[model samples]
Target: MAAKGLILLLFFSGLVSSNVEKTIFLAPEAREIAHDAVLLGRRLPVLTPSNWSLRTKIDAEFPTEGSSQGKVSWFFLDNLTEYQRYEVRICWAATQPTAFTLKTYEPSVAWEQPDLRASIERFVPNSQQQDIRTGVAEPTSDQPRISSALVLQVSAAADYFTKNATLMSNVPLVDVDVVLDPYILNVFPRSLLPNAACIVLVAIGSFFVSRWVIALIDGLLRADAALEKKQQ
Candidate 1:
């Protein structure tokens, strides 16, 4: 009886040791940009230039309903020569659990001209020009051009876990799935980008092999125990 129990324990231990699973996670960095534009019928020039950036955070839970969540923070700057106009848009996405996506839109424009007569003409010739002919003749190539910039920040997280004891613990198999989310950050130079989404499937077909290994060990231990019992 003792020998039989010993053999069974050894067999089950081997099965557990061979059934462990492995998983992976990722954390990405933020992105930034800079430039100029016109907003609401006003020309906004980047006097000191504009800047943009983004940051992201994520949390994931395994094998449960409503188990994952994420948050993204974004920032933007628009420098003006005098006064100018501008607009902004923001978007977010997730690739796991249920695949969630969101977007925010904001538009702004301003106009500010310099005080100096020469500076005013050099900076904003269109604002100084009175007649269409002088405006048309004054080297149109160097006309007060508008420049702007934007920044985008994103944060993300995920959770994943698998249980083998529930079903077909002795079988080998593989499975995979992917999710996606997309958003726009601006209207004029419309931003359209895709989020990551992919699934991988893998199965260990060593169930029968494991069972046989257990049987072999059990047979050896049983034989040794029988011999000992006989000797006693």
Candidate 2:
């Protein structure tokens, strides 16, 4: 019974320990700005990293069709980072080289991590680091020279692209809005309730086994006395 209880405890501990914590950083303003651009029938801001022009805008809040059920977005010319993915877009627009706004999802811990800031600098260097300001103005040009063509494809497959865009760019870098911290911490200590419940179950099972063993021993002793009395 003791061995059984120990085994059960170890098993539950392993299961709980296997839970991993993951972190990701994201600029919600990018998505918000993209949504507004799509709603107002306007082209989103662009940043050209290499010879290929790169543009980003959030198209849908949730992906309707895709293996990854993340928010839908349009990524032109591939600026996919290790943590970022682009969805479908309605049209492609010219790259705009201008100062862009980048607001963090979590302002408290956004700039605290040095590694995240380094990644942003390494991937996109032209963006000026500024305090996160709310209610940023949208870009509007009175004389629009180019028109965006429609994309007839219903949905894109799982494969976005083979290579990362930052590795292949050769053109002058433009200021692209990037969030320094893209990940949030998720602690699994909340799982302790289930672990405690399992431990209680093991205890109850052990109690029953112990009781059965005691009853069996008592019955054997009583039978031995009865047989001795019959022999006498």
Best by lDDT: 2
Per-residue lDDT of 213 in model 2 = 97
Q: Please give the TM-score that candidate 1 achieves against the real structure.
A: 0.17
Candidate models: Cα lDDT each: 0.28, 0.31
Q: Residue 154: error of model 2 in Å?
A: 35
Q: State the displacement of the C-alpha of residue 54, model 1, in Å, after optimal TM-score superposition.
A: 18
Candidate 2, residues 37-151: lDDT per residue as tens digits? 2222222122222222222222212223442332222211112233332222122212321222122222112224464333333322212222221222434554322222111
What is the alpha-carbon lDDT of model 2 when measured against the actual structure?
0.31
Q: Which candidate is the best by TM-score?
A: 2
- lDDT of model 2 at position 219: 100
Cα TM-score per model = 0.17, 0.27
Give model 1 RMSD, 1 decimal: 23.2
CA displacement after TM-score superposition, residue 103 of candidate 2 (Å): 21
Residue 72's lDDT within candidate 2 is: 21
- Look at candidate 2 and give me any clashing residue pairs: 24-182, 24-183, 25-181, 25-182, 25-183, 26-182
The sequence of per-residue lDDT tens digits that candidate 1 reaches over residues 1-232 is 9999999999877654421111111111221211121221122111122222222222222222432333222222333222222323222222222222222111121123222222213324332331111111212232333333222221222232347454322221111111111122222221222212111111233666688899999999999999999999
- Where model 1 places Cα greater than 4 Å from the true spot, the runs are 1-203, 230-232
In model 1, the Cα lDDT at residue 9 comes to: 100
